[model samples]
Target: MKTKIGLFLVVALFLNSCSTSKTVGKVPLYEVLVVNNDGGANIKFYEILTEANEIMLLLGDETLKKKVKKEDAQKSSFIILNAGPTKETFNRATVQKVLEKEDAIEVYIKDMQKNVEADLANENVFYPYSIIKINSKKQIVIK
Candidate 1:
C-alpha cells in the first residue's frame, strides 16, 4: 500500500510538471515605420525571423528598407506582416490576439478600414502592415 501510494504521487507530480504554458492576450503592435496616406492594407506575406542574416536580408533598410534590431537576444522572435499597395485605407492594422498553441503560434489581426476620422482631402494610396513580438519562436498561423 505504501509503495503504491508513493508511485501514484510521483506520477501525479510528473504530469503536473509537464503542463503546457501558453501566452494569450492582446499583444502590442510594433510600429517602426510610418507612411502617410488614406488607403487599405492587403497582406502580401508574413515572415518570421530569428537570425541576424535572415533579418538583414528581408528587414534591411538605410543601406537601402525593412529592418529589425537584430543584435538584441531578447528580440529574437519577430513576426512581420507586409501589406501591398491599397487604393483605400487599410489605415490601422492591429494585432488583436495571440495564442501560443502546442504546434504553432496563432495570431489574430484587424486589417480593415479604421473607424477613426482621417483627413481625406489629401487622399492618396497607402500601404500598411502590422508586426508583433511573440514570446515563443513557433511558426505563426494568422487567423
Candidate 2:
C-alpha cells in the first residue's frame, strides 16, 4: 500500500508538472503608442484609461509611469472606438451617437505622410490603436 501511494503521488506530481496554466489579465490590457512626428522622433507608449481621466505611460517593457492627461485620454478613447472592431460592425450614425455623449471631437491633420512614415517602423515597439501627429506649433494632427 505504501509503494502504491508513493507511485500515485509521483504520477500526480508528473501530471501537474505537465499541465500548464496561464492567468490572462483583463485590466491594463489596452495599449496606445504616441509617436512624436514633429521632426523629433521621440516615441512613447501609454496604457489608456478612459473612465479615470488618467494614463499610464509605458517607459520600457517592464516600467510604467502614470499621469493625468484628461484631453489625451479622452481623445485616445474616441479614436479607438472610431477605429476599432465596433466601427467594423456598426454604422457611422450609431458610432457617432456613442461618441457624441463623450464630447469626443474629431481631430484632422493633412500632409503628414512624410512625418508619419518616418516613425512607421518604430510602431513595432508598441501596439497602438492610432497614432496622433503633433506639428511644430505643438498642434494635434490626425493623419
Candidate 3:
C-alpha cells in the first residue's frame, strides 16, 4: 500500500509538472495616434483602456502592453511630447505632468496653423486628444 501511495504521488507530481495554464493579458481595444498634423513631432499611438465608465491610455509596444489603472489616469488631460525616434523605433510619450486641456489645445492649434520661423522658439508644442468618457446617463462627456 505504501508503494502504491508513492506511485500515485509520483504520477500526481508528473501531471502537475506537465499541466499548463493560460494567462490572459489585457488587450488594447482601441488605438489612437496623437499626430502634429504638421512636420514636427514623432507621432505615437496609445491603447485606450476603459472600465466603469472611466478611461485610461496605455502605452504599448509590438509585444507587450502596460495596463493603466483608471484612478491613476484621472487627470484633466494627457500630453505627449516628441521623444525623437531612434534608428530602431519611434517613441512618443506623456512622461510629463498632465496639463490643462485648453493649454494643450492652444499649443497644438498654434503649431498646426503657424509656420512662422520666428515662433520656432516655442516649437515644442504638444497636442491634446480629449477622451470622452461615458457618464451615468450613458452620454459621452469629455474628460
Measured by lDDT, the strongest candidate is: 1
Sort all candidates by lDDT, best to worst: 1, 3, 2
- lDDT tens digits, residues 77-135, model 2? 42221221121221121111111113333343222121122233553221223432111
Of 1 and 2, the candidate ahead on lDDT is 1
Residues 1-143, candidate 1, lDDT per residue (tens digit)? Answer: 99999999999999999999886986343333333343234435566766656655544545214334544324446666655555555445557777777888778876664333333453554555554556555666889
| Candidates in order: C-alpha RMSD to true structure | 10.8, 18.1, 12.3
- CA lDDT of 88 in candidate 1? 57
Two-way lDDT contest, 2 vs 3, winner: 3
User: Per-candidate TM vs. native?
Assistant: 0.47, 0.28, 0.28
Q: Which pairs of residues have clashing backbones in candidate 3? A: none
How far in Å is the alpha carbon of 98 misplaced in model 1? Answer: 0.5
lDDT of each: 0.56, 0.30, 0.33
Model 2: weakest 10-residue lDDT segment is 92-101
Per-residue alpha-carbon lDDT of model 3 for 1-143, expressed as tens digits?
A: 99999999999999998999898985322222343333333343332333433333333322113323344344322323333322222223322221233222222211222222223245444322222111122211122
lDDT, residue 103, model 2? 30
By summed lDDT, which 10 consecutive residues of candidate 3 come out lowest?
132-141
How high a TM-score does candidate 3 get?
0.28
Which candidate number has the best TM-score?
1
C-alpha lDDT (0 to 100) for residue 46 of candidate 2: 20
